[model samples]
Target: MSSRIPITLAGLAIVLSTASALYSAHALREQQQLVDHLNGQVARIQPYAFSRSDLDALLSRQSLAVAPPAAPEAPPAPMKRESAPIVGERRYGDATAQFSLIEYSDFECPYCKQYFAVPKAVVDSSRGNASVVFKHVPIHGEASRREAFAAECAAAQGGNDAFYRMAGAIFSSTAGNGTGTEKPLAVIASSIGLDGAALSRCIDNQEPLQKVKADFREAVELGIKETPTTIVRHNPSNRQVVLSGAKGPEDILRAMAKLVQGNGAAQ
Candidate 1:
């Protein structure tokens, strides 16, 4: 009887140990499943949490996945209207023409250089219908101012024709950006058949500086800021069209046509 009792107690102990081991294993598996479920929920909710760092990271990944955007196109140049009358002394073409192109230019501006011949081209193309007037804006400091004075001095020596000739010589010779020319102003004047010594005297005496300053002040009052600003005015009706920048001859012609058409004149 005693031996049977010992064996029974040993068997009971072994069975209890086996059941505890199985329970522990099952509990471990359930705990692992709960952890996995919690991790999955956190991942799903992370995007909506609005965390800046996480959002930035997501945006970066998206940007890398997509193609870059195309480059933007340049904007068109501006054209506008004004009521200012055409005012300048250096006139080219017929004085009695119906329309006048008043060119406010800088001798040392590259854009002014580009547009040097455009006004003359328009005048020529207009036949007897249009003219041009030159005004000095000399915004490129002393070099431009000196050139303006020299051209005016040519006018003083010769007349309107000499002024235009001097202007042409300067425009043709200058390297732009305040560099007047490789040749001296007087030399350029002589080359153009003006009295170079007299022109130099005129410049030294500052005879034409006031004319340049007046033009600049007039431009300021009219709100003209950029180089190569052209004012197309109809002498008959006092209608004005302002063109800013280095516009081609065609652009001026087109503006002229529009003005003529508006006035019920023949094309």
Candidate 2:
């Protein structure tokens, strides 16, 4: 039975190794969670950290003067809320809130990925004052469109929370401006604890795709020519500021401050 003792000891050692590895992994994950939480708080405070001169220079670089609507007759996109659920069903903040910030972006666009941080900062700063809206302008063709569909499906299944989680996954996994592959996209759906089989069915249907397409059509109509476009408006006042291209945290907050101050964009 001496041989049996050695085999038993080997098996016990393997078990201990695996248990140690799992515990280490769990500890690392917890540490990561704490770090991410602290970082978010720090990032939220960063926007307000700039001085007036710094903000002015940033705004000047942004050409703080927004361009006039291309056509006075054709309504500018994202500017009007006559259309309810402006960002569709996936939204954050008090539904009855008076301020609105809209971001038009593509899943495959790296700049768009970076700007995703803007909404949280704005919404957090606004507190009960502002609402964030997400508009899909998936410009990288079918692959991007597929990713958009996946996000919508997640929303359909688990509402706005799940939608954001899936987006975080897409933006985090996708490299450069490169597209995320189908398998990774599927994995994202599953990671969010969404129904993967149903997501597949939904993507196959493509009927829900109309929501994103409509946003695209409206963007074209508004002459919103690029990804990472931001539209900030204060309700009742209805003042607006439309910013195109990727913006630094200072740039976006200052632009948004125009709406919050009820100044709107300079005419």
Off by over 4 Å in 1: 1-88, 263-267
TM-score each candidate: 0.65, 0.65
Backbone N/Cα/C clashes per model? 0, 0
* Residue-wise C-alpha lDDT for candidate 1, range 1-267, written one tens digit per residue: 988999999999999999999999997786455445434433443221111111111111211111344655976454231212222499889999988899988788777877878788767756577888998877665788789888888888777899889888998899888777779999999998987887787776666756777787777778776778899887776777898777766566656655654542331
Residue 86, model 2: lDDT of 15
Looking at model 1, the pairs that clash are none
Displacement of residue 227 (Cα, Å) in model 1 is 0.8
- TM-score of candidate 2 relative to the true fold: 0.65
lDDT of 2 by residue, 57-158 (tens): 121122111235367676645432111221365677776776677778778777777778777666776546667788877666566777888888778777
Candidate 2: stretches off by over 4 Å: 1-87, 176-178, 265-267
Q: How far is 105's C-alpha from truth in model 2 (Å)?
A: 0.5
The TM-score of candidate 1 is: 0.65
Model 1's alpha-carbon lDDT is 0.72
Best by lDDT: 1
User: What is candidate 1's CA lDDT for residue 98?
Assistant: 83
- Scored by lDDT, model 2 comes in at 0.66
